[model samples]
Target: MSILNHRTVVLDPQFKDLEEFMLSIPALFTENKGVVIHKGRNELRRIEYKGVEYVVKAFHRPNIINRFVYGVFRPSKAKRSYHYANIYREIGVGTPTPVGYMNIRKGLLFDRSYYVTLTSTCPYRYEDLFTHDFPYAEEVLRAIGRTTAVLHEHGYAHKDYGRANILFQQLEDGSIKLEIVDLNRMAVGPIDMKAGCKNFERLPATPEMHRLMAEEYAKARGFDAQKCFELMQAYRSVQPGKIDGLY
Candidate 1:
């Protein structure tokens, strides 16, 4: 951990050598030195340092009220992302390795912040399972279901558990390894069956897909499969908006 000037930087001990590089991201971001992977509410860039590839997420500067809140009371989103990544790692959940996070403060208010993680090697995301006929689709979905149960059992709920945020890789032994991203909004605490089932509401998939996943999740959690499926369907039906004809 290092605090210099108006910037506060915290990095994983393993990445201590990258402190200087991490601190330079805010400046390099302005110069557009990396490949932009996402550009919307937040900007994500794929950048390289030496031979290592990393994804740096530049969080949008908070609004007036939030600036003070994040600066004084709350942890910045980037800091939360970095903190959650380490938790996921300690619990054996799959997520890109977090390198660090940096927050630039102006006076008493928070300015821009960035979260950095090692680039994920997974070639497919959860959306691909439903969009195309990927190999081992059923097995992969079941794996995701079991993984979700594990997350809930561990008291971690991803608020933005959308398709794009879930990633997976096919291993040599034909087993699926699931990974989740977009960590800042994750809620950590005791989770009930209803909340666990409702967590699937953000997934973009068909009813059949949801049922299958719910069943697998129920099996893992020792809950009634039918009830789990029903609860999941109920929550999904009432979601504010639809995605890909389903919610």
Candidate 2:
């Protein structure tokens, strides 16, 4: 691979050797390709490196205009994912630990970028709860609501705060632990009540379910449950599609 200009950040000492392999991403991607976790604008491939599992996300190629724009104006998606993963860790939010990120440039313009993170197998995603009447559904939803409230209170606004992005694992103590993924589409800023409610817009849960979550969020934020539920309903009414880079 011809790396005209490349940058990578390794957060964990255990994964320091992952940096050397960034140069051979093409070969590693081809040799260790596993099941596809997600496939849309970007692709998430589960791969193993020296017996340690990791998820490598390949971002879509940019257009002519975006090549320059991303190369000059903004950090690539890989960099953003790496940046937010550390920030989430710093803010006491749970996410997959970032292994590293790489940007391959062709001359001055950016060619491709990739993000690597440790793979985690949570028992359930919020999306499963929406589709099935799982046991402890209300409790799980409430916990997620409280967790999201804490994130918003700390100024962590997840642009793609949909069901699939939130993962939960049930513990032996009958409590659930939550972790977030697909973290590149996130923002950090002051989040008001309305903005907080809007964050749940993409969750396709029923109105009653949303109300249940609103109660928990209201409790955390000291807001009215009815008002929060109403705002979430209004935001959900628009029903925007999944976030994409072109937007």
Candidate 3:
């Protein structure tokens, strides 16, 4: 989508008075955060003026290579962050609507990189839910699996798939909606079977857990049990390493 695609966006200019736009790339934190919700090396926070919340990403040492590799395919990581904003909108996927992003240059005032998403209430990570008791927990897991397959069928892969990155937004009347939190690494093209499998490989849980997630996905996407297993198996067979990488 075009930069102006959104209804109204307070992009880089919101910080123009405090800082000029540049790609120091790491200083995005100071520019994006008007009020700090919490801070750490991997994730940062900002309270949106509209009373929403957003988690800002700040680059660290370990991810430098991954960020650089992704840049080869995308002009900016911030740009790729919006890839899902379009992807989800087009395909009915559930995720936070990407608000905007900024990449600041090093040596520039408070240089860094960051992107923002319209925040929901205190989001619960998927894995954390398993530690407690909840109804339809199994069904929700399956929903994620089926939802993921739908993404693959449409020609995309969330290379970073795991319970932690997925969040739950509790609704009124005691219901829930799921959202994919991180997107800087999501990519286009044939699903990287290896990367896709890697997503589930970390899910060391009961066979029932795996079964439930896959079942929910198959049911939601109308794949049935057999096809879902085939897809999961196909993904698992791929080696856990770089495939084509991402944008």
* Root-mean-square deviation of Cα positions for candidate 2 versus the true structure, in angstroms: 3.1
The local distance difference test score of each candidate is 0.86, 0.81, 0.56
> What is the per-residue lDDT of model 2 for residues 1-247, given as tens digits with 9 covering 90 to 100?
4456655444467777777666667566667567788889988898876888888898998998999888778899999898888888887778887888888777678778889888876868988985666687878889878988988888887888877889987778988778898888876777778878888888887898889899999999999999999988888899664322222
Give candidate 3 regions above 4 Å deviation. Answer: 1-41, 48-50, 61-74, 106-111, 170-176, 192-199, 219-247
Q: Best candidate, TM-score-wise?
A: 1
- Which segments of model 2 are wrong by more than 4 Å? 1-11, 30-32, 241-247
* Cα displacement (Å) at residue 244, model 3: 8.7
The order by descending TM-score is 1, 2, 3
Candidate 1 regions with alpha-carbon error over 4 angstroms: 1-5, 240-247
Better of 2 and 3 by TM-score: 2
Error of 1 at 134 (Å): 0.9
TM-scores of the candidates in the order shown:
0.93, 0.89, 0.66
* Model 3 lDDT per residue over 137-160, tens place: 765676677667777667776666
- Displacement of the residue 225 alpha carbon in candidate 2, Å: 1.6
Q: What is the lDDT of residue 56 in candidate 1?
A: 97
TM-score of 1: 0.93
| Residue 174 lDDT (model 2) | 86
